[model samples]
Target: MEKYIQEDLDKKIILLTGPRQTGKTTLSKMLNPDYDYFNFDNPDDRLGLQEKSWDRSKKLVIFNELHKLKNWKSWLKGVYDTEGIPPSILVTGSAKLDTYRKVGDSLAGRFFQFRLHPLDLKEIHNFLNPGNLEAELDKLLFSGGFPEPFLNGTTRFYNRWKKSHLDIILKQDLIDLENVQQIIQIETLIQLLKHRVGSPISYASLSQDLQCSDKTVKRWLMILENMYIIFKVPPFHKNIARAIQKAPKFYFYDTGQVIGEQGIKLENTVACAIQKEIHFREDCFGETKKLFYLRNKDKKEIDFCTTSGDDPVLMVEVKWKDNSLSSNFEVFRKFFPQLKMVQVVKELKKEKTFPNGAEIRTAHNWLSTLTLP
Candidate 1:
């Protein structure tokens, strides 16, 4: 991501957005030493931005939390339109800048957006080259993929860090960006989502639990998504509207936030890794890939499905240790015979491919080298 981001910065404005503390600011500073950084949260920095007083001699100008500015898009457009990319413009934010709406002009063709996710199995293995992937996987599942806690490699530290992390994102970031005031309800929503991993989320169920309306629950979920606290995977259907109308599954960006058995955590981990891959393809390569789960009215389901444009291209099922093929695969096979099917198990003695061309893979090995179809 650093390499790709650097290459894109020279040609176009790089809008880097991700979960807070995923190292967006750290990575941006590392890109160049002689860079001027202004954060909108800081009062002095906000003044500087309003006055347009950043050092022009710097190689890069990073406006952290730029989305908070009123009509930020118009301001940034004026900057780019008047002064081209000599001092490269890099906007970093914790919220989704593209989705963050403000009353401003469109920045359609002037910028390239990159969503930075937490370190995944493949990223950690590639960078750190851990000899014991199973141990690393355990640590990742326990500590999560955030830079600080994952590198600390301690459950005690992550336990303490998790609370503060959510507090800041929910109390500070969420309130500031979304203007959402139901802090306690949103926290409960997070806890509710933790248990509901790998299952379709019913807005009515959640609303009932939170003592709110279904519309309020849906809005809160969207707010959580924009803040990168959770991501939803809608059920795959040929009709896009129907797919959205159906119950969709949600997973946390931080794996440690999930509360469940190892099987459920493993499913969340796989979902995160698969989502990271999909985001990479879309961000870096400009591919139109989407993440979804497979389910029907009969409750027959496959864990995940990836599609390119509108065509379903791949199906993935996750299991704890069951090596036997999923009968659900055959159910979906009848409709899309050419789709690639794979079942990844955490504890597999041998990798095998059934006669139907569906493959069973070791979860750790596959996730460490996961690539999109």
Candidate 2:
């Protein structure tokens, strides 16, 4: 698979991070075919690398999940400072390396972080023929983008993959990377979070339920976020202090992982597809753009807020039904008269412009147009 970060690998100490089984290792192999590979999961390999010092003269060295080790950052600093500049270094981990407690006072400003999300329309197009968007959406929503599950296309295989991935992360990754003692509590917390995907996370409530402190809950959530397991989307409120604050909506970095763990629902699927389209458009435009959801004091909400600089370029509302516009859109339209476009996905079969001058387009057509210039 073609990665968005491959071109920038050599120039920076690229930190390739994502949820388990998103193909970080595969991408690393493709990027550095001649490099020496070491995986911390392997006992011998971990010991060897830990025992010996890093030599800068080597062609390339790829460290996989080394952040699990307590001295990983210190060891890396020693290698980086002593080694020559010609040789390249690559590190891959399922969890966030920077979140590691041991990564202190070393490797500052030396690495660039890149997140690899689940298979999106852009990546699917690159891998296979960009034939029909509807069919592609069906495949992506049901089969999901994980390599093994998507390739096998069987319920049994997908179930096994989900089970094994969760077990490994809970049994191995967390234990190795974090000194997590209450394994059951963490597992329960993850399952609970999965159910509350698009809702604002309540750390205090979660802590109370888990019989832990608020700070402990926050720390665990951070660990999950850094591990690429989940992400939070902040509300877009400019000059509106009354807007919803303090809590942020949570989302899985890979919608597929969420679907596999939880059951696939139409609303969730459509939301994921729309989110993917918004992100792709931003990436293609090469502008500092962002995706946000809006909610006001009156409980009026917009599904997506796409912006360039301080200006609101577009406001998108996604729905699974056709020809449906909420009263919320009218409220939003009144707030910002200049916001002329509102996209309703899965609802409209064809692109249609409202009499009020807002252009309503199909999700597929809109996403296809987002290509790198």
Candidate 3:
């Protein structure tokens, strides 16, 4: 398997974070072939790293899932400060290292953070064939980009893999990372969230369903988000002060995970893949681009908003089936007259420029055209 060369390899310390089974460990091994590997998942390996913190060898070091340890940040800071920077350090984890609640003021400005999302269209194209976009999209949406399940090429195998993966994350990862007293509540919250994808999350409603307080619901949601089990995309509102502010649309990190757990149609699965690709691109390349969903008081919605600085470079509406532009486009054009609008369809004949000056393009073509600026 070809490793996607990350851009920030030369930085002092690189923290690679993503949801479980996104190939973080595999990528770390490939990044530093000569590094001494230590994973907290193994009791012996964890004990070794804890006992030998002062051994300042010059060889590269790769720490896997060490963020679960309470003193990991401080320990790494001491190791790096005393070792004189000869050994490059790479830390890979399933959760966001910076989001650990017990993390102290250490290792700041000493590391560059990079998030590794599941394989996108570009990465798959580079690895496989660039021309096989439709097949790749179909395979990725159905089987997901988790290396093991996708390679296995059977729905039963993928479903079993997803169940086992979810169990480990819920049972082991959460318990190791957080100091929660009610593990069952957190597990139930996660299961409930799978049904709320693409819907605005209400804290009060969630709290009521879980028989917990609003604050507890919020905290647990943050924990789940930090662990990359789920994430929220805020709505785009510039000048509209009265626009809805408290609610955010939620999505799982991987669409296949959601599909395997809940049954989503092929069309909805495709939409989720496209959404993940847009968000991943924006996050990986910051300042140059932004991705958000659009909503207004008049009950209009757009699937995605991609912008370059203040100017809206593109406004996109995704539909599973062939549908005409909703009146919402007219309202949006009234506000941002200069921005280009587009409609992305799962099934379309190439790209078409509508008579109303909007572009109608296949999702695969549009995603392939996007490049980091």
Candidate 4:
């Protein structure tokens, strides 16, 4: 990511956004030691931005939390159009920076965006090179992929950190980004969703449980999505509009936030991993890849699917201990034989492949080497 980010910094403004503690600031600073830094949350830095008073001699200038500025897109456009890029510009934010990219034509082609996510199997394998991948997987499942908690590797620290993490995002970030007066209700919604991971969410059901209208429930879900608290995976259907109208499954950005059985956690973790992989291709290679789940009216379901444009590429089923092949694989194969199918098992004694090209693979090994077509 650093290599690709560096390459883009030379030619365009780099907009890096992600969850609150996904190491955006740390990664930005590491890119250049002598870079000038400004935070919109700081009074002094805010004043400096208003005055355009940063040192231009530095090779890199990093603007932290710049999205908080009113009319920031026009402001940045003016800066880029007039001053040009001797000192490369890198903007970092916690919220979805791309959401505001469509506000106006102010920043049409001046920036390249990158979304940073929590650590996953492939990243741990590449960077940490863990001697025991299975143990690292255990740590990721238990403490989550956040830098601090995962590194601490202690139950007590994770518990304490988890409380403060939610408080800051819900109490501080939410208040800053939105005007919703129902913080408690939003928190309750998160709890309700935690237990329903890997299942389609019915807006009617959610509204009834929260004593709110369906429209309000949908608005709250969008708010949560923009804040990077959760992501939704819609069902796979050839008709795009019809697919969107169907109920979508939700998963948390933080795996530790899930409250359910081990199988649920494993599914959520795999979802995150696939999402990260998709984002990587879109960001670095300009590929058209998306994530989805397969379900029909008959209740036959597969855990995940990846598509290139409108064509399905891969189908995956996640299991904690069951090594037996999923019957749904054969069902889907009959329809889309060109798509690769695999059953990822956490406790498989041996990996095998069927004559039809479907496979049963060990979860840790397969995930560590996961890549898109």
Candidate 1 to truth, TM: 0.98
lDDT of 1 by residue, 1-373 (tens): 8889889888899999999999999999999999999999999999999999999999999999999998899999999999988799999999999887698899999999999999999998899999999888888788789999999987789999998999999888887878888888888889889999999889988888999999999899999899998999999998878877899999999999989988889899999999999999999999999999999889999999999888889999999899799999999999989899999898888999988999999888989999887
In model 1, where do residues sit more than 4 Å from their true spots? none
For candidate 2, list the clashing residue pairs, or say none.
Answer: 321-347
Query: In model 4, where do residues sit more than 4 Å from their true spots?
Result: 101-105
TM for every model, in the order presented, reads 0.98, 0.83, 0.86, 0.98
Candidate rank order under lDDT: 1, 4, 3, 2
- Per-candidate clashes come to 0, 1, 0, 0
lDDT of each: 0.91, 0.67, 0.70, 0.90
lDDT of 4 by residue, 147-190 (tens): 88988889999999988998988898788777678999999999
Best model number under lDDT = 1
What is the alpha-carbon lDDT for the whole of candidate 1?
0.91
| lDDT string, candidate 3, 224-275, tens digits | 8888877766677775464344577667766675533322433335344555
Candidate 2 least-lDDT 10 residues: 259-268
- Compared with the true structure, model 2 gives a TM-score of 0.83
Please identify which of the two predictions, 3 or 4, would achieve the higher lDDT against the true structure: 4
